[model samples]
Target: MVTTCDIIRMMNRISQYRQANRLLVIMPTWVGDAVMATPTLRALRNLYRTAHITALTRRSNRPLLDACPWIDDILSAWPPQIKIQRDGAQGGVFGVVRRLAAGQFDTAVLLPNGIRSALTTMLAGIPRRVGYDRNGRGFLLTDRLAPRRQLGAFVPVPTLDYYLAIVRYLGAEHIDRTMRLFTRPEDDQRAEDLLVDAGWSRQIPLVVINPGASFGDAKLWPIERFAAVSDRCVDELGAFVAIGGASKERPLLQKVIDRASRPIFDLPGHGVDMKVFKSVVRKASVVICNDTGARHMATALGTPAASVFGPTDPAWTETGVAVDRQVRVDVDCGPCQLRKCPLDHRCMTRINPQMVFDHVGELVGWNDELKHKGQDQDNSVARSVGYS
Candidate 1:
């Protein structure tokens, strides 16, 4: 096995000149940010057209990377949480760094704004290192771009746009904001089968509800609010609901499912791998989620999505690039981007459940009164035709 340090040296030699053909990308380890990095990956593909682009990311997020077409290779950084865990797991980072150095990448784009990502790319000795100038890692990066804007009072942008800025540093003239993931046709078939197995109607529009956000309390919408919106979808449109997330979020997912009066197919802890998960979202008519990884996944899969934002500004990766809309309450104190709320999480709590329900109704392509009237008209037509 090649050592990461040796790989770095080799990559540096190959990349000393402009090879453009062999480019390596370092992904943000966080699941949400990993998805946000998709636009950057797409921008690279757009610029190079024929370059082999490999992405270095955490092992747990391999499924998402595997399903993405923009990535040529999926390099795993085991214990993807290692950086966040460095205070507890310190001894093995050098070994991990060494393995990374062995890949012989020409150009390295670091998506995570942390010192660790830049240091790893530097340690790997990739010739060209690119990232934002933050976290005191400016010396490690060869290309540092200024952040587009500061966070505002209530305007939330998505994180994907921030990651795409690196592509500009690589000389990309046109940057597309649409995030993308690719799935095999068989994967879509499998998801359809799963839906049928769960007694869901494939013909009816599908809605995926993800009630968890991993960025702590910064981006979470109230669970009760999620349930309220879910119930309206079921009662009004008779649409099938698929609740998805990892095993860790099951408790919160269950709470939303329990509050919903309509029956929902709970896929929490359902071992649906990333490919299948992408397929699931692909078949969904719309996705309702917090500003979590799944929201980005839904956009990549081309599912119209409504993502709620709270503490984190959506400026880096704005929602609705491919989704229909991003629903955030106009709270005066929101976009604080804090892990924990200093003021009782009022930003998220004040959003009325009715507001979410109203948003859902809009996406389903009808207002509440319009839906009722349409149903009444359909009933009248059936009665006039003597079919009822």
Candidate 2:
């Protein structure tokens, strides 16, 4: 239904922002980037309390913010990179442009650094466009921030801060870099039902492991290593271990389960949507995952997490607030930031199970003394795990 003709017509009818009563946020296309953009959204909400704040993101990433209180509503716009090359959705590039145009937003905030984002907002007839001036799109922005770079490439700034700089440019003073997320009651109830059905007792401490990374296989740690860690949690820590998958990571999740000695509770492969998936993450005492969006999900939910890093730089995902437990090995080739590994995948492979399990133990504080002593105190577990 979204045609090039409709898109062009909308652009021709461009109107300047008088009061910016209605605002549109052009969210990052990737899930990890989307999660990192939460603080910026919160800042926008605080600054413009009366304005209607709507987030425009990819269809898949849209569900992750279902319970986010900062935005009034969210809409999906599927572009080619995700729609055509990866996810088979009907909304092509033009369709996305068309949908964004129909929103009639006053001020648009471009989150992703892609030139396509700047171009689309301009085509949507959004006056007062704001974004980082990168990829030769400075001419398209009404207000643009020059990116910080070293020799030639941009610096590996923490993602939350990288997004928050735009908010500062918009005249925000006090910056809160706290990454946050929420879950619905219905989804929590559904998660409770499913967790119980899967033999997870409410009394047992929950440890969730995400073996899959949507980024690429380069970010994945060995499945056998994950299985070993799961078994350690069950045997040593006396915890209920669960493994989850995103959309296309079911087989990877299954492999972790198949190789494990103990029974692992399944989260995503059980037909739960991203909303329900988040509730499960919230209920977890500690989460273990690959360097993916799930790592940010856990942090946002205030659940202590342990992450395995490989191909990507840890500097990119670092939340300025929390000290997360991360397991990685220094290899010559990485953090190469490659989607696929060309040679031996030594960065991830060398990080053994014990390395991850030790950190998980620290995050969980699984011993009986620490558990019983800290039950009544606020953030006692977090304090113990050094989350703050």
Candidate 3:
């Protein structure tokens, strides 16, 4: 039924859409999600070489994209109190829409599935709004994609691949799966200074441990177990142990520190920002952490990491990179994906320090030469073996 002329016209229109000059990409709110979106962002940049690519994300997540060459600008989507105005008057939501309209973006790709994200682009009158058809926002998107489903259920895809699907739908080519992160020179210098101040010599390998999880307490391994692992790393491998996490995690870090047999550096207690944190992780010989942002950061930086999993499914967060070593105990109830556990929390408690230490030692090539140094330390501090 289609004529040759009609087919040519359709092809021309598609070409025009692909040639859009100004593009806005809505990024996810979480730090790990933002990091995972980097590959999609890079693909978009490469696909539209001349387009001005701006990344819109939450204020807290802006730092994750620092030094990203693909992004021309990073816009904050949060701090609701901060208003954008038009015509010399405060615009509120309407004003925000007006300001976005003024930019005349040809296309907007929504990475987050929330209705608010779609509504913003739709209200802004972007000609080409692309996003998945979930959260009841399909009506607002000009290009709505239905997620792949199986057996009457939406299959859970890795977050990294899930994000990349958006750019792929937009005709992006040569999608790079390698996750990327960047840190400033000053951040690296600060990290070096911190290490020097901690009396950590360059000769000794550094093992960074994160004992907190923003997801929930259920995701956290026991503080005593973390302390035991730190003690073992210091004792057997002669590695300098450092504890790092969000500022809110200082109490947890202190618990680990108080129980540790030897002194450990507290990075969060020293007020290290995300930039400094990335620098620190990049420099570390190995990182051990819960199913949180720190693990993703370490993996992206090509640093070896032992990522502990409890209630969360490892497949959903898998880095798909060789550097990550995921650790989890087989429990009858878990991968429940619940923020809080209703039971005894055996999923985490059963995973002892020795199990973690063995995995970490394997990844970092543990030196038996230093085992003699640990022999004099108190063996009864905590049971270090026979964990199922």
Highest TM-score scorer: 2
TM-score per candidate, chains pooled:
0.80, 0.87, 0.87
| lDDT, residue 173, model 3 | 66
* Candidate 2 lDDT tens digits, 203-272: 6778999888878878889899999999999999888988887767888889999999998987766787
lDDT of 2: 0.80
Per-residue alpha-carbon lDDT of candidate 1 for residues 151-198, written as tens digits (9 for 90 to 100) = 633233467666766676566776766556767878878888988888
> What order do candidates take by lDDT, descending?
2, 3, 1
Query: What is the C-alpha RMSD, rounded to one decimal, of candidate 1?
Result: 9.8
lDDT (Cα, 0-100) at 83 in candidate 3? 51
RMSD of each: 9.8, 7.6, 7.5
Q: Rank the candidates by TM-score, best first.
A: 2, 3, 1
Q: What is the lDDT of residue 212 in candidate 3?
A: 84
Best by lDDT: 2
Model with the higher TM-score, candidate 1 or 2: 2
Residue-level lDDT for 79 in candidate 1:
34
